[model samples]
Target: MKLKRTMAILMAGVTCAGALAGCGGSGSKDTGSAASNSGGLTELTFVMASRDEFMSSIEEAMVAEAEPLGYKIVSQDAQNDSSKQIQYIETAVNGGAEAVICLPVDADGTQSLIDAVGEKNLVFVNRPPTNYSELAADNVTYVGSNEDTSGYYQGEYLANYFKQKGQKEVKYLMIQGTLGQVSTTKRSEGVIKALKDNGINPVEASAPVVADYDRPTAQEMIQPLLTSGKEFDCIIANNDAMALGAIEACKDAGVEINFPIVGIDCTADGAKAVQDGDMAMTVFQNPVGQGKGAVIAADNMINGKKLGTGMEELGALDTSGKDYSDSIFWIPFEPVTKDNVADYM
Candidate 1:
């Protein structure tokens, strides 16, 4: 069943690829009773930052896991606006949602969301709030992979590539996700730390360019750099979309990539890129695991059970060696290179 679900999730990535990038959800804000509906279904609100390629996959998995269990997911997209996200949270709460599952637009604005939810169960998915540890409670928890681990895997792959080539000093271009995101900061810092830890002298080829995790923005941001004839040993990106963008930019500029280009989120296209030798490697941030985990967490919280109750069915959960209180649940990230990319695909 896990293998079948995994394949369905991978297929979802392809299906959701054509979804409008910044489109907001059409969920109505009508007020309703919090009690179970006439069909005996409990509604849980799922508010997303936006329906990007990878996020849409998570949404699909969440819906698949939720429906059969007699829970309805009322999904909303904030279109990357924090204000809209808060508004949606209030609307969900006012509309009698027993729980709210949010992929926050601004991690820093988590307090506002907490205040708006006001005693209802809350499960934060994917992007965790900046103050996650401090804010955790019986009714609130986080479900996602450790962001630092994602980049550390990228660095480990790159470090091994360079060490095998007997190169100690490496210059690289970095394509970053949205600034101010904890994922962006941690992923950027974690890779550098891993390279140094593995005895590699890493130097930036240029100041990192921010692309807000958009492929077209990343392609446009790095095109000039690729054409400028800057000598760099590799390219690093916060996620697969930007890495693919960098690959496209290099191809457009006729630059033969001779070095590693690493990223996170082994989306279907990213795994294919690794298999085809375009992307050196990527980290598999499991959407199926995260989506399932979020639903389980919210359900457990609403029932006054442990936050991680019944999550073991999803597979092993890596807590990153931290003895976190029950308020946090981590889904592990796997590194996908040419040798292992086929397994992910």
Candidate 2:
């Protein structure tokens, strides 16, 4: 398992509201055991960071994959609430869930969750905690693609596209996700770095707007910017929902600027946006891989088996690190430009 990368390429895209795909339904807040099938399947609970399409996909994939592997999976929506997530964790702890796959509301805010998980295995999905490599433990590990890669890819593509057209100092409006989330921070840094490193002077069009990874919010937040006459040649949104929002906003204002917009997730809407030429590109962050991978890791953990042993085909499960306390597994991100958008869809 290796993360072989050219340090030379990829950065930013943001949040998810993926296709209406994947298995499983929204789980009850109740903590109770589902009767075991032919064998005593390990009971698992997934406490989601929020209730959205991407989270739903993760829950669905986990349930689908876990059932055959002699595991029962249930999920809870934290709705971006740390307190609610903690209460659910308390329920999971009391209900005797063999493992908990949590997507916390805040990446850095896990002290309460740590206290609640007790001896149960806590597998974080998608979002990594702040200073993760330093803070992660044997019981608390993360499974996700590198958030920076999406953004970096966006920046790299934009850099190359603009540079090729003999363009310089491309001004961009960055639509950010929730500020404190790990995805937001790393994606922001990574894309900006990619632009600078690629010999492109990416000027900020205006103050970055926080859309909270929602379309309406992005649309509302951007109206004022358009009215202010602040011009931007590109828009790098954290997620496709926001990127699409920017497009609609531009259309509504009847702005002559057909800004090149990029986003993350490569959701159905995002891909269509690319195909229809409403947006430029997006990076594919696979929920199925992440969901199945989490279930596989939990199965190994509960059985007292090695975590990375069976996960070779998914991605290199990086269980090794200097003074490592956790078994982390990383899924890689891929860029989806017009050149390759159809393959992803």
State TM-scores per candidate.
0.88, 0.85
Best lDDT goes to which candidate?
1
Q: Write the per-residue lDDT of candidate 1 for residues 1-345, one digit (tens) a residue.
A: 235234211101111111222112211121234567677888888999998888888888888888886788778999988889889999987877778999998898888888888877678899888975533344566788778788999889889999999999899899999999999999999899899999999999899999988899999999999878788999999999999999999899898988788989998899889999999999988898788878877776666555545765666544333423355666777888898777776
The deviation in Å at residue 198 for candidate 1 is 0.5
Which has the greatest TM-score?
A: 1
Model 2 steric clash total: 11
Name the runs in model 2 displaced over 4 angstroms: 1-41, 133-136, 316-326
**lDDT by residue (tens digit), candidate 2, 1-345:** 112211111111121112211102211112233345345876688898778877887787788889888787767888778999999988977776656888888777876787788766677778877755422344565677777577899989999989988887889889999998878888888889999999999899898999999998998898788878777778889999899898888888886546688999878788889988888888878777788878877776666565554566654434333222234566778888788777766
Q: What's the lDDT for all of these models? A: 0.78, 0.73
